[model samples]
Structure formats: C-alpha cells, structure tokens
Target: MQPSGTPSRRVSAFDIALALGGLLFIFLSAQNAGPAIAALRADGVQGTFTAQRLDCVEHPGHEQCSWVGDFRSDDAAVVREGIGFYGSERSTFTPGATSPAFDTGRLGHVYGPGGSNEWVIIAALLLVGLALTLRPLLRLRRPPRTPAPPPVPEHLP
Candidate 1:
C-alpha cells in the first residue's frame, strides 16, 4: 500500500455485536416462518377446534382474545388439548362451539378456516435481520475514502 492518506475500515466490537444480533433475529424468525407460512396455506392436519373457553387480555385501548380449546382431526386420528384457536374473536365462538382449523404442528395454537396474515410480520423481521447482518459487511467492501486533502491553510501576507 503506497497510499498513506486512505482511511481504514476496521470491524469493531459493535459491528460484531450487530451481526450476532442479526443472526439471532434471522434464526428466530426462520424458525417460525415455515410453520406460519404453512398455517397460512392451510397445509397441515385438518381439524375442528372446540371452544372450551375464551381467554382475553385487556390492553390500554382494546382487548385481545383467543379461544382455548381442543382440536380433533376430521378422521379422529389426531387430537390436541388446550390449544388456542388463532385469530378467534369474542363473537367468533362461544362455549362448546367448533370451527374448522388447521394444525401445522406449531405448539399451543392452530389456524382457522381463514388463514392469518402472520407471514407478513415474519417477512419483515427477516428483512430487518438481513439488513442488520449485511450493513457492516457492506461498509467494509466499499473503497476506502482518501483523507480530505489537508485543510487548505490560510496564506498571510
């Protein structure tokens, strides 16, 4: 390297941390992405969820609700207990009511006849993770900037 004025790009601990955090996000999102997509596609055990109870959590402005129940496959071959019916609302079901559902083997929750839009959030997380992971590496690839020519000195008469 004959050039002495070029600024060097060094990978700092912060960059490593960012990359590691990004990998964690990517891993967590990927773990759920497949099941979420499958649930959206209704590609899993077709079943009916029997509402045993409605669980609600009150928030500042509104309440969130989920129907906790049992899911039984149409053929009666598969049955799961105490699983949540995803996207169930207060008016959607009452005690002892049943709705068609799909179980993509995701624990504790199943999809209803109408698939959910969870994949969108998962995709966003993946994009954010990818950006975080690549940002620093990309910075390192750019040509080093030449140091601004030493600030022009004022000439005195």
Candidate 2:
C-alpha cells in the first residue's frame, strides 16, 4: 500500500541545475566580498547622477545585456563617466539629477557598515536553497521499508 500523507518527490535534472546555478552565484559573491569591502573602504570621488541605462538584446545568434550609467564627476570641471566590470549595478539615474557616485560614498550609504553584511545574508539564503535541492535526492536514497506481519497463533486457529 502506498504511504499516506505527503508524497516524496523525485529529484529531477532541473532541480540539480537550479541548485548548481544558485551555488555558483553564492560562490562568486562570496569570493567578491573581500574585494568589495576593500573597495568600500577606499576613498572615491563625488559625482552627480546623469543617466542610467539597462540595455538588453536577444537574437537567434546572440544575446547581450548592458548596464551602465553616466555620472558627472565633481572633483574637477563637469565630466561624464561611469564604471563597470567588478563594480556594476542596474540603476535608474535620470539626466540632470544629482546623486552619489556608486563606487564612492553611495555604496557605503546604501549598504551601511561597509557593505559586507549583505553577502552573509545572501550566503544564508543560498544555503537554504541548497538544502531544499538536496532534500529530494536524499529522500530517493532511502526507500520506504514495510513491516513484516506477525506470525499467527496456533491456539487461536
């Protein structure tokens, strides 16, 4: 007879793939935490927010996504610039608006206390995801066991 109550789920390929992807994100983010903290400590120039763009394109042959923003540097005369690669964010900065430059005072203000705490939060969430993903596989390893019936009493018969 089938077990009553909740049914066990079979681990599928998609679950493994998703777990791997989540793990990859956690790993990558963990690796960058140190550097990010360092960068947060470093001094940076002030800039005014000029514009922000999140451009994405998809085609049969290729796909591309670009995230960038223009900031007006304040150290000197008016100059438009942006940063990328290791420190990049999807933002919405309107032209003529003044806002803190990302790598500089903005990050510290937004993240609060050097910005390292967020990484720990991300790791914890990913760990929960990892456990959920492994649950199905772990369940599959232990098959349900049925109890053997007791021997009939000869006297009763």
Q: Which candidate's lDDT is highest?
A: 1
Q: Could you tally the backbone clashes for each prediction?
A: 0, 0
Q: Give lDDT tens digits, candidate 1, residues 48-69.
A: 9999999999999999998999
List the candidates' TM-scores in order.
Answer: 0.90, 0.36
Model 2 bad stretches (over 4 Å): 1-22, 31-46, 52-68, 72-94, 104-121, 129-157
Top of the candidates by TM-score:
1
The whole-model lDDT of each prediction reads: 0.90, 0.50
Candidate 2 has an lDDT of 0.50
**Model 1: runs farther than 4 Å from truth?**
1-3, 151-157
Candidate 2's TM-score reads 0.36
- Model 1 shows how many backbone clashes? 0
- In angstroms, give how far residue 105 of model 1 lies from its true place: 0.6
